[model samples]
Target: MLYRAPHKTAVDPDTGELFTDLLVIVVPDDSAKSALVEDPSVPFFTVPHFDGYNAVLVQESRLGEISRDELEEILIDAWAARAPKELVAEFFADQ
Candidate 1:
């Protein structure tokens, strides 16, 4: 999500209007993206942005294709990549 100061806007790409239903998930690494792509059952893809490096898009409709366990791991890694090391260690210590 774009943390642009005071106001956070979710603009629709097609109409250039604000939208509230979108979810932007930042992937942890290329390895995660590669794994997702390799799995034929799951619908995951990376885009040309950031030189097609790191970020992956998980389609809203096909979110169910990925299992709960897999999703948890992915989210954990994603947060870990961005969050502070001490916080990550404390939070995920028992996990």
Candidate 2:
């Protein structure tokens, strides 16, 4: 899902435009810290203004640094976190 930051939190230093290479994924609380610690190589950061919010901003352009399987797992976890229970269950059943 596209997360429009309440304010412009991401700006490209070079082009000085809103960064287009970003993907905001909702996750469980405190997941951001663990995600960063788990893979420091991946550019993951939490919005300080969003202290209670459970989401992480990932550099979409840097996703290539991770394996396809890892990306799929991240996407699945994000989807399952917000998807309706029935839909999630159905999706897993088909898998």
Candidate 3:
């Protein structure tokens, strides 16, 4: 595990108050998850519940570790994995 914390903080749009919330889960591709974990700078982890061992918990604090292009590629793969085949094909028609 890269790091663990009790909760994350966010601001309330209405009152400008801070509140705690659980970490968000991102279901990226297995290969992408493995690649991210292998890089020490990227903070990615697995959970025992819904994510099991295959998915990752992306910490907002460590988002700087990944490059924008790298992240976009990984996310596209993740989305394609769950998206309809026809949709994916249409999106990547030129490729």
Consecutive 10-residue window with the lowest summed lDDT within model 3: 1-10
Q: Between which residue pairs do clashes occur in model 1?
A: none
Itemize residue pairs with steric clashes in candidate 2: none
Best by the TM-score measure: 2
Q: State every prediction's TM-score relative to the real structure.
A: 0.65, 0.70, 0.58
In order, candidate lDDTs are 0.62, 0.69, 0.58
Q: What are the per-residue Cα lDDT tens digits for candidate 3 across 65-94?
A: 779986677667767767899999999996
Task: Please list the residue runs of candidate 1 whose C-alpha ends up more than 4 Å from where it truly belongs after superposition.
Answer: 1-23, 50-52
> Candidate 1: deviation at residue 66, Å?
1.5
TM-score-better candidate, 1 vs 2: 2
Off by over 4 Å in 3: 1-31, 50-53
Off-target runs (Cα >4 Å) in candidate 2 are 3-8, 11-20, 36-38
Model 2 per-residue lDDT tens digits across residues 1-95: 45454347666657777766677877745764466535677666665654677777766777788788876877787788889999999999999
lDDT of 3 at 78: 66
